[model samples]
Target chain A: MAEIKLNNLTKRWGDFIGVDDQSLHIKDREFLVLLGPSGCGKTTTMRMIAGLEEPTAGEIWIGDRMVNDDLPKDRDVAMVFQNYGLYPHMTIFDNIAYPLKVRGTDKSEIRPRVEKAAEQVELTEFLHRKPKALSGGQRQRVALARAIVRTPKVFLMDEPLSNLDAKLRVTMRAELKHLSRALQITTVYVTHDQIEAMTLADRVAVMKNGIIQQLGTPDDIYNNPANLFVAGFIGSPAMNLINGSVTDGMFVTTGGTRLVPVKSPDREKAILGVRADDMHVHEAGQGDIDVTIYAFENTGESTLLTVQWGKQRVIARGDRHLRKDQDDVVGISLNQDHLYLFDPETEDRIEM
Target chain B: MRDNTLKYLLVLPAVLVVFVTAIWPLIEAARLSFTVGRLNRPGSLDQYLGWENYLWAFFEEPAFWNSVWVTAIYTLLTVGLTTVFALGLALLLAPGGRLRSSAQALLILPFAMSPALIGVSFRFMFNPEFGLFDAFFGIVFPPLADVSWLADPQLALAVVVMADVWGWIPFLTLVLIGGLASVPRDTVEAAQVDGASGWRVFKDVTLPQLAPVLAVVVILKSIFSLKTFDQVFMLTNGGPGTATQTLSHYIYFNGMKYGQIGYSASVAWLMVIPMIFLTYAYAKFVFRKADQ
Candidate 1:
């Protein structure tokens, strides 16, 4: 296993930059995830490290060697593509054994190692079949088996679980975590799915527009977002940002009402950021602010109330048993410790 | 009417057209092979020859055997050269940028030219006195300056094979480009990342997937090479004392020029045997691919 470092790495296609100049240091045997929306350059960054793509500028050092000029085979990295990239013509056993065979491993030692890898992915019985003959999830396992069959310096996975059905994705996500931990290889996984990043990554690098917006542990990013973008992007039913201002240590809404006590100085334009779960709902007037419910959704685990606050809507996660309808008045109180303030102009967090 | 019956009814006209155009001619050829069929003799068409013509072509005629040998060599050279060159050209053009795509577009032009025209063009280009290729070759190797290209038997046959290969390469290259396009990019990338070198990636991953398309190309080219007539007829015309005469040219000579229609028909039917096997192989590849 090796540590991977990118020093001012950048990838540009003509005038359009795929990955703007960014640097990252991935620890040895750590599962670091690159998380972002589509077209946000997370996959591009992973591809650069895998040597599938060439960086326009900067050095990629795996262990101690700069691998910018090396071909992918010479880099000794194993990658699982988004499409799985299983050899459709080869048997599952052959697919798993390809990496070892190509690397000139002894012929006699191949079968046992292939069988063991297949068994790890629970694919022993399907070894004789081609990828086309297997189900989608089974094909995914073959891809994973192929990558792990050889103990390469690093493992690269690009949205490997995105193709499976939801249930299979969850199951495979747990399997991937277990396999990554068991193997203890340096892995850089890229995915747009936030939950995958939170659960699987030792440190998640949240990216946007070819830049890493936040790089930290899941709890650190979730609880204390570095910017308005991070706060708005991380949580489900995303963090509510109300257009308002801080006036005399009180956060006031744009519609001219004092909403909550704050520790910040007065500012004309700021956004109040709070998570959906942090908003406590009560009968009208029992909480900090009373508002009419714009919409209510029951997601089985919990109920979500989209409450009208001035001209903006804020979603609050209520207890699963709490029932409310449209236009129903409910009082909502923000957990003061969890509340965030951001400057509207720069979109940066304002410490309060 | 039931749906199946109506479907059969819809195909009736095509079946009739095929019967009249293809099957009837085959049956008539079979019948003609059984007779004496001499154009000069008034009653020769009706005279029963039985297996005499078949036996004569098989044993008695050295010229017929020479034509068979010539056809075999011609087919091998044309099919092998065309396929190899076309595969190379397809690989060169498959990456597809503005220049490569434009080159690919130009590839269709050679195919659009008739094979007979290609033969004439090659004959002109190889003219010993003032031809483009003749002068170029003479300049490149001065020993060729005085030699006549179409006069030597071996050189004449080579010219015919070159004409055929040239005419066929463009079409085969286009088919192979389509084949290369269908190979999965990610699988090739996977092989690369799996620690395969460039050549290994092609041999282990790309070529195996490309086998079906290559098989189809080989079979189709073999059939066409076996039946080669147009370019040979136009370029060499079985020249240099019958050294370049393929089986089709031999059949044409006996049937139309010598007026031995019966013997020619038997040889023509013999050539169809290999074609049947090739078509069967091609069909198997196509159907198996469809199943996948």
Candidate 2:
């Protein structure tokens, strides 16, 4: 319901900084995910926006109002903590009704609101149960219900599904995505899990060391990473990065295997990035790189082939029907169009 | 099998100490309460008295019953005040930041002080002469000069209760503060975001979380208050016409002072019965409920 903007926000503890100078703009009704590794200040950024933590400097504006001085409740935001911090003494009914009660809603209005929120989370039947009596997934639903009952302008979720089992986490992730669209609230979710960020976010803000590494749609981040960190961090089995140089208008690895550039242009010493899906194995062809298979993983429907050339080993996803295990030299073809180049010293993207 | 035997051998010394120091004394006390002995009649082992001393305590001795009532009143007042003050201090101190450690250390300093020292200090302060309380009041009512607080029937008992509260509240507060500190910060933050005010957050989130610890504080303070003797003995010596006399003081008066060993043993038994019942009932009622 409100657009949030952080202008040079920073958080510090004595001499140490939790979140360095960072700036981000979250549009209204957009699901923006702050994704990063642990201790990278994703949660700290979310807490600052929610007014649960104070920023050391700069300002936070929400829907034209500078709310840096406001308390969490005054900021018109509801948060779902990673631990699903439900009051253990209160039943689910009271827990969901707490926000309404605090806001001085009418007695008649509170009942239906609580009921509607509970119904959305599929927790109507367990209304009278305490949090301790509920399972992990059920408790998360209660926490979600508690947030939705208020119908606040913004929803802040800090890795809310991280506590559930793998299957439950998947289910909850889908549920949260669906619920965010239905509620149409400006939501900022923080998670270290890239899969969750990829699936749940309308726009993912990849952060590292308290700074935004890349801020774009999932496809923009996955296909055209702005830097080496994003290119390496955003993908599974990750993008294969190898040190290479431009010679004779062809990208050549240190092992002297020449990769015919799909787009031949200008490049010197730069890191070459290629996705696993873009690479095709060639036994022998016009444009092929010879490499010996190091290992192969069969994951039911697909197989991952890890090949070593010189000191470099890169994993490529392939069809289970095509490749088996370690064998003789295999020929591989690279999708030159999808290849990314990064300057080795700066770790910054270099124009190809 | 060798490891199990070695583990048992390691704990043998602890088991022996429990048997000799704890269980043996309890058994001896039970046996002695059933027998009769006097200083002069120590050589004769045929002095067997069953429930006569108990009967005398309950019916024949009016002063004994009065002492019981006084002790009960003092214990209840001391425990009740201490529990209330301790819980309040814990709530105020548990949220610590920069000043938290200093505040906690200062609060616990009173408990670290010796009870005998506390008694002497309070006695001197409340003394109607050049003492603090009297001197402060003497500015208003100059007619009040050197009024003996320990000699007054009502003031003597009040002073003992006050001294006990000062000595014991810090201990209860420290325990409750540790318990309150463990109340999840996540739960409290959730409540705050849910639009709960300060009082509501404490009532719904903190109070329920601290129930088990508060129960412990109350029970421990009650047990200590019931057996209180140091402050009263050091200050008033159970004087002011038996006004400040507790059961422990009465037992001391009979056994050591008057040398009525048989009678004193009976009074001690009379006191121990209620304490045993209380300990059992408290563990069953409050502590068990808290565990759930």
Best by DockQ: 1
| A174-238: candidate 2 lDDT, tens digit per residue | 89988988999999999988999999999999999888999999999998899999999988978
Residue-pair clashes per prediction, in order, are 0, 0
lDDT for B9 in candidate 1 is: 99
lDDT of 1 by residue, A1-352 (tens): 9999999999998899889899999999999999989999999999898888999999999999999999999998999999998888899999999999999999999999999999999999999998989999999999999998989999999999999999999999999999998999999999999889989999999999999999999998888898988888898989999889999999999998898888899999989998899999999999988999999999999999999888999999999999989999999998988899999999999887
DockQ for every model comes to 0.80, 0.70
Docking class of 2: medium
Badly placed stretches (over 4 Å) of model 1 are: B40-48
Best model per TM-score: 1
